[model samples]
Target: MSRRSVSTRGVKWPIVSAVGLHGGMDVLELRAEADAILAELVGAPGGSARLREDQWQAVAALVEERRRALVVQRTGWGKSAVYFVATALLRRRGSGPTVIVSPLLALMRNQVEAAARAGIRAHTINSANPEEWESIHEEVERGETDVLLVSPERLNAVDFREQVLPKLAATTGLLVVDEAHCISDWGHDFRPDYRRLRAMLAELPAGVPVLATTATANARVTADVAEQLGTGGGEALVLRGPLDRESLRLGVVRLPDAAHRLGWLAEHLDDLQGSGIVYALTVAAAEEATAFLRQRGFRVASYTGRTENADRLQAEADLQQNRVKALIATSALGMGFDKPDLGFVVHLGSPSSPIAYYQQVGRAGRGVEHADVLLLPGKEDEAIWRYFADTAFPPEARVRETLSALAGAGRPLSVPALEAVVDLRRTRLETMLKVLDVDGAVKRVKGGWISTGEQWVYDSERYAWVARQRAAEQQAMRDYVSTTQCRMEFLRRQLDDEGAVPCGRCDNCAGPWVDSDVSAETLTGAVKELDRPGVEIEPRRMWPTGMPALGIDLKGRISAKEQCSTGRALGRLSDIGWGNRLRPLLAENAPDGPVPDDVLQAAVAVLADWARSPGGWAPDVPDASARPVGVVAVPSVTRPQLVGSLAEGIAAVGRLPFLGTLTYGGPGGAHAARRSNSAQRLRGLFGAFTVSEELAGALARSPGPVLLVDDYTDSGWTLAVAARLLRQAGAQQVLPLVLAAAG
Candidate 1:
């Protein structure tokens, strides 16, 4: 049977081909035709307002529901266009007006400009005066306003209650609440005013249909919406899914401090020329960092809540257009914004929480290729967060303030206006808001403002809870800093919400742990050594009194392994399978001087296990020593035969030299990095001579030196592994040329 092939053309190709590669003429014509309408809505709406496949389905759902159906979306995916298109569908119906509750003035203006450009009659209500608002009201009354957007600050006014909601309620219109996740405290953005949204909808007599959308909301937020809006269980059509995008290469880089980290960023940034974002903890730092980077010739922009709307727009536009190579921002850049083709996202410090970090890092790599998200390690990030929490955040006082603010407004007020009236600085207010947001005290709306819910005094309320949680996480971070596990694996575990093991995507998984363990063990003996009665304990441990045994726990001491009284006793007990039988056996059968055969066998097994395990860690044990076992010297990679051989060895394991974010030592591990991710590919490329005498001809000696030279070393794991394998294979001496002994 013959099968038919698909034809390249399927429709009115001329009309359908609106855009294609390289700025095709058809796309330019379509944009020209769309310019007028889009320009008007430019400032009126700010979101990922582009058309998408699922949005088409939503447009169909809204029509099917008769009233607009609610749309709940995750972040980094455009949710704004779902409503824009639904309203466009409304225009075709010519029956109802569409009203949007936006909390950002810049966003409202942006959407308005876009609509005006698109030839759509878009208008905004004025928060400054009733008179100006009446004009917009009149247009809505005439049914000429296809889309009427209002900041919640404007909508919460008594004047608006008496005029606008009544008219909008009576008219056949669609009510869209963008950034709907603000309704719950579980979200990063929360607004108390958004809680009263259902009640306000009830105030509208014609039953204005409600539609909500957000970039992210876990299951609780989704469930809360149904409960809050009386949509009933499953009444709201849920289309939630994983926020993952395959194109994104999510990773974080941690350092001991900010100074060196920033230096590291500057070093690698030469090739990363497209737009990117750097998130800092404070507004000042954001500005300072941007200026510093800019002085260094990086085309950078900075944004915080303090940045003027005009400046913010220009900065965002500059980033989107690649005019600015990078933007130093805070949480201000997280939601309802899109700047495609970003090459990197540099976190000036570690994120306050995994959620914030995940969201911020998720921003990069949205383009066709891989991108980076780096988190500089240290206390600066944590200290700034704590200062405000400890200083101005009296939880109860904040709760009272929020409750009072909510009560005074009577109607819901936008977050910005509330922030304006609050007595504290922006950071304090934000902390209060995050608390209120979590406790369902307020809700968030698109454009970064928040809304309050019901009246409630906050006495050590949200602040206390958030602060406590932050503190616990901070302790975990401290523990991580002091830990001996591979740094990359620890980072991976810290970021995993489900407590999964290291992802192998990190440096630890990539093999850094090998060098750390081996080097550390070499300093401490591999066997336990009993001290003479008055010999004194190891200095690494604090000189605690009691003149106890070496195995006893002592404060201020660090060793190959921590030995607490209880743990030592438990270990001793476990060794004999039980206390009674083991005590007698150890007393009667102490090996007469020479080491026992079983102990020797155990050490061999442990060594074998360490060789095979990922990041294997072993404490110094008693008594087995080696005679500088067969050494295998690795030559410099510049030697074609050596480079080919090394390449051959790495490729044998199906790995490859990954050029981005990973390398093996030599001037930043240049040669080793060259063979990183593509190890497998190179192995195939050198199939004939993989580890052949052609590469090891010099290792023909009885204890040869296998010195592999490279420019730099992050950790000496790669060379160590090669050295170990060659030594095991009977090459005399195995020493890494780059593994310099302790300074």
Candidate 2:
């Protein structure tokens, strides 16, 4: 192989070129042409800008030799530039428009703008812009579009896959996979949808160039992706660079608890260099942090999966323009967010994988001289990691169950319809279906998914290996937190960077640069904010789709007469304050006992606040109903003691009579129905609860309102079903209260 070297910031890096010239263009001529294009793409003064040697090598491999390549570099190393430059060069040679499979809407937006600066006309087709899809497709068909960007999910869409993908694959000048590490199941953020790219790759016309790029693939992930990229081509030329970011100053800030961690952020957020991101492990934590920060007079916004699309776009714009001090976010904002001068990144809890942490922190310090990256590791991080781990590829038996259900349906079954038969959660079931779709076990069409009747063997070995890999990565993250070695070097080494060395910038290399001390007042405020517990448990107003498929007549919205009032919970299990306290107690192995005194007190306080708050049962409210005349417990087979105690305590506190518990009239027992989808959960509880004669008499005596108590509420189906029974029996109004809520 012939190699070229470019000097950047006084360091020489080698670029490998494994192919000869094409289209009467020699290596030297191609290099000159690529340099000219780079200058135009970057809008350099008088076309003075030039391509780095490695970038030129990758470009040359694609344009001059029509070869596939993978580029693994740091966040700001110009991976997008490679594809844009190649697209320009390939188009000039009379090739077809480039097709780029991008991951995030933010990334696609940035790419479109960047391509314009280079004089390349770009268009995108994602879920966000459905109305423009027809026009965009026409533009591509007319050969007026320079590049067309589509999300991975778009590749498998029935219309796109059948109508658009074939034409695009046949005519595309270049194929680019941005954030390519997602294709590897071994990668920290593997997405099953990316696996569909293999079919597209295989369908490409011979000699079409391809480029895959990412910033956070270790050796294992790199190898996996490279192998996939070579599906049609002989081999992919991989150009991996050093992972060090000279502008990043990494450190760990150890705090006593969630309160201290949040308090430190409140006290020192402005002291950080500039506007940046504050990452939380869960959506609830992010929302909580955002609320507390705003209450403290800081301009911050929350961005999570639950955030509306318009709000997400607005939040991204706010951060880009420095309107907000920080965007408290979950992993939803992790990849493809482009901010050149993001001054700092503060993680409320360590991610399960060091590679994922590196990818997130890489968002900062990309274009600045120095940026701070701090990790405030929480003790609850491991528990969260385990919770997420449980959602991985379902057990072999579950997979078979899904396949059998599809096979027996005799026609297409929508995900919601499948949910009634399959016990998996909606998201998990959809993910499994996508994976099965790729494996040819199922096919998605106009109505929904249908069985292909393909013999699908469960790859238990691969799944087990992946699970082990996840465990190892989690352990590596724990080590990274406690390691005495250089923090940056540790991260680099985890990514298999052979050049990893002490950067002398991290807290481990030098002394900590961030202040850990939080003011007493700030700490008190944080504690108070966290201690105030009460999350509205929105009642399930509508039945789940495809309920009739399960032999149940329920459909559409549940009638208001049978519906429970919007209820309340002491706190969410994902909450930073109460979650830490409640997780262990509600854990599968935790001993079931009466609610603790502290929890009981918290529940009482929650009730007090609920009474006086707006739309509450306070007498001052115009249409306020009388307070609960009695309390009734929802029978809990797993924690009967806890439910009984909570109901009795609340009734005693309110000086209301304690109604007897609802009898368990089971088709399927209460505990047996746990963790299933809404339809399945409702089916299990349809007639599972019955108002006993004693409870019915108590409700008849009062007939005003009743407090329905349960140990926990996740799907809200239990409360909904139980409330319906009570309403049908006698109670005028039912208000549900629970110890903890699950997101």
Q: Which candidate is the best by TM-score?
A: 2
Candidate 2 scores a C-alpha RMSD against the true structure in Å of: 3.1
Backbone collision count in every prediction? 110, 0
Q: Per-residue lDDT for 248-321 in model 1, tens only?
A: 43444555434444455555556553668888776645655565566557787888876886788788788778
lDDT of 2 by residue, 1-743 (tens): 56676533232345554345333446667677776776666666354456666677788789878999999999888788788888988898899999999888888887788789778999999989999999999999999999999998898899999999999999999999989999999898888889999998999999999999999999999999999999987899899999999989999999999999989999989999889999999998998899899999999999998999899999999999999999999988868898888999999999999999999999887767889999999989998887767668999888998899888988888988888888899989989999999999999999999899989999989988998999999999999999999999999999999999999999988898777899999999999988888988888899999888778899999987788887888888877888888898888878889889999999899989888877675333234467888999998777888889999999898888998899997854576766889988988888778888988888899878789999788899999999999999988888889988987
Candidate 1: stretches off by over 4 Å: 1-53, 67-72, 104-119, 123-138, 204-208, 231-234, 390-743
Off by over 4 Å in 2: 1-33, 43-47, 617-624, 667-669
Candidate 2 positional error at 516, Å: 1.9
